[model samples]
Target: MDIVFTVLILLLAVSVSGIAIRLLPFSLPLPLVQIAIGAFLAWPALGLHVTFDPDIFMMLFIPPLLFADGWRIPKREFYMARRSILMLALGLVFMTVLAVGYFVHALVPAISLPVAFALAAVLSPTDAVALSGIVGKGKIPGRLMHILEGEALMNDASGLVALKFAIAAAMTGVFSLRDASISFVIIALGGLLVGAAVSWLFSFASTHLLNLNEEGDPAPGVVMTLLIPFAAYLIAERFELSGILAAVAAGMMMNYTSVANAGPASTRIRAGTTWSMIEFVFNGMVFILLGLQFPHILGRALLDAHETSDVQVGLLIGYIAAVAVALYAMRFVWVWLLRWFASRGATKHGVANAVPGLRTATVTTVAGVRGAVTLAGVLSLPEVLKNGAPLPGRDLAIFIASGVILVSLLVAVVTLPFLLHGWRKHKDPHAAEETLARTMAAQAAIRAIDDVHETESADLDESAAAYAADVTARVMDLYRRRLASLDDEQESRDLARRAESLEFTMKLAAMRAERKTLLALRNSRTINDETLNKLMREVDLSETALTARRK
Candidate 1:
C-alpha cells in the first residue's frame, strides 16, 4: 500500500481501538484486540501487505514516543522510584540478554551467539504504552506503576544499544566486551548532552516567543514544542548517538525548563489535546503494526524451510518458546530478590505497597512485554553480510522475535487482570488513597491562589483584583468544606463532588457566552482573524476545564 493509505488504515485502526476500549469488557486489553484486528487485515488472503521499513519506523515513530514518555513521567515519583527503575532498566536488561541469549543459542545450534544476543536484546525492553492499559484501568500500586514507567523510558536505549553492538559483531565476526561497554557509555552520555542542549535551545526560543505574544497568538511556541523531539532526535542521530536517549532527554528538559508550562493557559491546554491525539494514534498503531509483521515473519520462515537445515527449521518453535520462558523466569527471580532486599527495614504494608510479594513480582514479570522496538530491531537485520552471502538465520531471528513478542503480550493480557483482581479483592474498593491525593492537591491549589495578590495582575485594576480575590476565596471555601467533611462519609463526599461539578457547569456557561461574543465581533469585522482565534482559544480553554468536570 502507498504511504498515505497506510497512514489512513492505521488511524482508522486507532479510532476503532479507542471506541472498543470503552465498549469492550474490562478484561480485554485494547492493544491485544487491535493487534488481532491488524493480523486479520494483513493476512495473505486479505492482500493488505504493509512493509516494515526500519529507518522509517525509527524516524516517524520512536522519537515522539520516547519524548512523550519522558515528558509525562512524574518527576517526583520518578526520583522516588529511581533505584528500582535503574535495577530493572539496566541490570535486569543485561541479565535477560545474557541469559536468554545463551539459552537460545544452546537451543538452536544454527543461530549464532551474537545473533541470539541480538534477538535477546530486541526482546528485552518492555513497551510502556502496551502496559499502560493495565495500569490505567487496574488498581496497581503507585510505586510499582512509576517504576514500570521509568524502566520503560530508559530500557529502550539500553536494549537498542545492545542490539546494535550485537548486530555489528554478528556481521563482522568480531566482538570486544570492553570496547562495547565504553562505546555504550559514550553513545548514552552523548545523546543526553545533545538532547539537553537542544531542549534548552527550544525552550529558550519558546519562552521568548510566548513573552512576545503574551496578549496575542501562541502558535509559535506551540509549533516549537512540537518540533523539539524531532530536532533532538535528528541531531543526535546525525552524530552517531542514541536517538532514543536524545528524545527522552529532550522531553525531560522541556519539563524541567517549563517551556510548556510557561505558555498561556489556552496554549497549554490546546497543546495537551494535540499531544493526546498524537499519543493515541502512535500508541494504538504501533501494536497493530507489530501484529501486521507476523504474517511476513511466518511467510519468510516458511520460505526458508528449503534453504536452511532441518535442525534450524525444527528448532525455531523451541527457541521462541525457550526465549519467551527465559525472559519471565529471569525477570521473576531478579525482581523477587530486589523486592525482598528493598522490603527490609520497611513496614510490611509499605514494602508490599512498593514492591509487593511473589505474586505481584510474577505479575510484573509478565507485564514486561516486548512490542514495536523488538519488531523494529529484528526487521532492521542486515540482508547480506560483508562477504556478500545472505545473513544466516535472519528469518529465523525475526520469527523468533515475533513469537516472543506475541507470547509476552498474550501472557500480560491473560495474567494481569487475574493477578491485580486478586490483589484488589483484599483491599477497600473505595480507596482512601485517592481521597488523600485529592485533598493534598486542593490544599496546594489554595496555597497558590493565596499568593496571587503578590502578582502584577493584582495591582492592575481594583475591580479585576477584587474579582480574582473573591473567586479564590470562594474556591478555598469549597476546598475547606470538602476537607472538613472527609470523615469516611460517602454521602458528604458525594455532595461535595456534585457541588464542584455544579460550579464547573456554571463557569462553562460564562465561557460559552464569551465565545459567542467573540464570534459576534468577528462576524462584524471588529476583530481580525488572529485576534479572533486567540480569544476563541482562551474561551475554549476555560470550556475544556469545565467540560472535563461535567464528564
Candidate 2:
C-alpha cells in the first residue's frame, strides 16, 4: 500500500508540475519547477520522504529516456557530428577524470585519489536534457544542439564505465592502466553490438512471427517497444557490459529497423504517442526524485559539518564551488582546443571565421550541467571495503556531487538566457530541405492519385468514368495548390499560401461544428454514446491533422 501510494503521489506531482509552470507569470524551466515542487513536498510539515536507491533509479529511468533520445535525434546530424561528439564524450571525459580528479584531491587532501577520480568520472557526463529544459526547443543553433545531444547520448556510458573502474581500484587497492583500457573497449563494443542485435531480433520477430504488418491491434508491438530499452539494458549488464550504451545503441538501431520503417501507420502513431507520454512522465519523475533527495543530502551534510565547526560548512561549500569551477574550466579548455584544431583544418580548406568564439565556448562549458547520472554514480560508491571498514569521504563525496549538480543547474539557469537571447531569431538552416521534401511528397502524392484514378476508370461506364475523373481532379488539385505554394515565384507562392490558410480556417470550423453536433446528439439521446464517440473520434482526428499541417 505504501509503495502504491508513493507511486501515485509521484505521478500526481508530475502532472501538477506541468500545470504549475503554466500558471506562473514568469518563464521557468519545467525541470526547475518540478524540482521546486519536490523540495516543497519534502518539507518536514508535509512529511514526504522517499528512499533514494541508485541502482534502481538508474535501471528504471535512464534506459527509456536515453532510448527515446537516440530514436528521435536526427541520424544524419549525429553522423556528421560524430567526430566532435567522440571528442567531447570520450576525450573530454577522460581528460576531466584526470585533470579534475587531481584537482579535487589537491583541493581536499582528505579525499583519496581513487575516490576523487570516481567523483570526477561521475561529474563528466553532462545533462543535455537539463540543458534542453533550460533553453526551450529551437533556442540553440541546430548544429550545436545536435552535437551536444550526440555527446550526451554517448558520454553517460563512458562516464559510468570510468566510475566502475575507479570504484574497483578503490576497493582492491590495485589499478592496471592496460587491463582497464582493454576492458573499456570490450565493454563499449560488446554493449553496442548486443543492443543493435537485440533491436534487429525484435524487428524480425515483429514482422515475421508477430505479423505486425497486417491490419490488427498495434498495442502488443507498441508494448514491446517500451520493453526494448529495459531488455537491452538488462541483457548487456548480464554479460558484464555497458548497459547505458546498450540502451542508446538499441534506440539508434531503431532508425534502421523494419519495425520502425515498415510498421503500419496506426502502429507508428500509437507508438509515438506512447513513447512521448512515457518520456514526459519518466523525465518528470527523475527530476522530482532528485529534488526529493537534495534537501536531505544537502541539509544533513551541512548540519553535520556545522556541528563539527562553522568553518567546516564553508569548507564543504568551497569544495563544491572549486570542483564545479574545475569542471567548467577543464570543459572550456578541451572544447576550445577541439574547435581551434577544427578551425585550422577548415582554414586549410578555405573556410572563413572557423575559429572558436568565446561565447560559443562559454555556452558549451555552462551547458555541461550534471544530472541524475552523476548523482546516481556518486551515490553508488560502496560504503565498505575488503576489510569491512567504512569507505573514507563517501558522505563528503555525495554532498559535493549533489552540490555541484545544483550549482551547475543554477548557473545555467542564470546565464543561459542572457547568452541565448535573440538566438531563435536566426533563420532556420533546414528550411530549404523541408520545403524540398514537401514539394517532392506533394508531387508524388499527385502521381499516385492519378495512377489509381486511371486503374479505377479503365472499365467503367462513361458517366461513371466522368465522375471518377472529376473526383480525381478535385483530389489532385489539393496537391497542385500545395506545389504552387512551394514555387519559386513569390506572387504565386503568396497566393497559394493565402488560399491554403483560408481552406484551413474553413476546415477547422467545419470539424468543430461536427463535434458540436455529435455532442448534442449524445446529450439529446438522438444517438447512442458509442455512435457519438465513433463520429467524434473521426472529427478529432481530422482536426488534429488539419491543425498539424497548418503549424
Find the candidate with the highest lDDT and give its number: 2
**What tens digits encode model 1's per-residue C-alpha lDDT throughout 1-551?**
48788789878888987788788766577788788778877978867778889888888888998898898888888887889998998899888889988988888777888888998898888887888774564466666777888999889999999999989999998989999999999999999999999998877766674572364565666677778888999999999998889999998887877556655675776678788888888888887887787867865785586477777666666777777888888999999988877776365555445544777787788879888988998888898899998877787788888888888888887777778875644454336876788678878877776776457365668888777777777867966765745646888878777776677778877888888899999999999999999899778766775677455
How displaced is residue 462 in candidate 1, in Å?
14
Per-residue CA lDDT of model 2 for 12-99, tens digit only, reads 9999999988999999999999888888888889878999999999899999999999999999999999999999999999999999
**Sliding window of 10 residues with minimal summed lDDT for model 1:** 422-431
Model 2: colliding residue pairs: none
Off by over 4 Å in 1: 23-27, 209-213, 299-315, 344-356, 425-540, 547-551
Error of 1 at 532 (Å): 11
